[model samples]
Target: MFSKSSNETKIAVLEERLTSYEIMIKKIDEAIQIMGKTSQTISKMLAVHEEKLDNTHKNDELIIDRIKTMESKNTEEHHRVIERFEFIDSKINDRIEILDKKVDEVTKFRWLILGGVMIISFIFSQSSMVVDILTPDTDNVRIEKPR
Candidate 1:
């Protein structure tokens, strides 16, 4: 009877150890499933992030292209405005030259008219004095009225 009890005790201890190993194996499987889920989630998030990065890169390229186009257009417009200003400058210079010639001609004509007036007065007048401020010179002049 003592030998039979010892055998039964050994069997019980073996069964308990087996049960503990089984439970440990189950826990390991659950942990492996959780790790797989976590890895899958990380992979999905990484893919989304890569897609967003690509979109942002494309948008940046588009913005750069637009800026280049605007700069080219601005340069062309600047060139056009410069040419127009040059043309206007030349026209204004030409107008100034014409006005200068006209003013010279008017001044010369005015001087000529003044000289003609002085010569006519000297030839037709009896007195040589041009402008008398105080009184008129009547020393050698005589005037009579017939009635």
Candidate 2:
């Protein structure tokens, strides 16, 4: 009977230990469930962040493309302005050349007129009849008493 009582006490202690192990297993299961929920939430947040990053990258690409387009337009406009300026400069130079030619022609005409005037004056001065007709004959004038 003493051996039987000792066996019963051992069984009771083992049963109590088994109950404690079951409780511990239940708490670990609850912890595992909480960790799973937290992991799911973190995954969702990461997905959202990745999506936002993708959108930002897309917007950046669009902005860069727009900037490149603007740069190209500016370059084209600059080239056009330069070409126009060069064209205007050539036109101005051509007009200046034409004016110079006109001035040379006018100067030659003036010189020709001056030469003609000088020749006419020399001819008139050397001619005796012209000189006599143009000037008064004071030396040849004789005063008569009977006039």
Candidate 3:
């Protein structure tokens, strides 16, 4: 009977140790589940951040392209304006040359008419001087008779 009692006490001790091991296993399973949920949440957040960064990069590229296009257009317009100004300057110079030629022609015509008038007046004056020199005094004989 003493041997039987000792054997039963050993069996009870084994059963309590088994129950403690089961409780520890349950706690470990709960910890593993929490860790899995946290990993999934972190992965989702990272994906969203990556998508936003990609969109921002694309928008920056688009803006840069548009700015380059506008600059090219502005440069083209500036070239056109410069060309127009050069054309106008050339036209003004041509008009000035034409005006100078016209002025020279007018001066020549004036000198020619003035020279013709001076020559005609000189010829008329010479004729009158010759007539006065050739005319004789006809009243001398009548005066002697009266005396």
Candidate 4:
């Protein structure tokens, strides 16, 4: 009877240990499942980020191309404006030259007219003096009136 009782106690202790080990294995399985879910979530996030990066890169290229095109167009427009300004300046210079020539001609004509007037005045004044000297003195001379 003593040996039978000891064997029964040993069996009960082994059964308890087996139950604990089974519980521990169940917890370990749950932890593994959680880790797999976390890995999947991380992978999905990484894929999304990569896609966004690609789109951003494409957009940057497009923006750079547009800027280059605008710069070329601006350069062309600048050249056209410069050419137009130069043409206008040349035209103005030509007009100014023509005006200067006309002013010079007018000045010369004015001087010629003034010199002619002075010469004519001098001639008239000398002629009067000569006439007075050639005529006899009216104070000592007698004059007769004819009917």
Number of the top lDDT candidate: 2
What stretches of model 3 exceed 4 Å from their correct place?
1-20, 95-147
lDDT of 2 by residue, 1-147 (tens): 569889899999999999999999999999999999999999999999999999999999999999999999999999999999999999999999999999999999999999999999999999999999999777776878995
Q: What's model 2's lDDT at 25?
A: 96
How do the residues 1-147 of candidate 3 rate in per-residue lDDT, one tens digit apiece?
569878888778877887888898889888888888888888898999999999999999999999999999999999999999999989999999999999999999999999999997777668967567667656765435564
TM-score computed on alpha carbons, candidate 1:
0.70
- Per-candidate clashes come to 0, 0, 0, 0
Return the clash pairs for model 3, or none.
none
Candidate 4 per-residue lDDT over residues 40-144, each given as its tens digit: 999999999999999999999999999999999999999999999999999999999999999999999999999999998788668977668767777766677
**How would you order the candidates by TM-score, starting with the best?**
4, 1, 2, 3
Candidate 1: residue 8 lDDT (0-100): 90
For every candidate in turn, the CA RMSD to the true structure comes to 6.4, 5.0, 8.2, 6.0
**TM-score of each candidate?**
0.70, 0.63, 0.52, 0.71
Worst 10 residues of 3 by lDDT: 138-147
Give the candidate order by descending lDDT: 2, 4, 1, 3
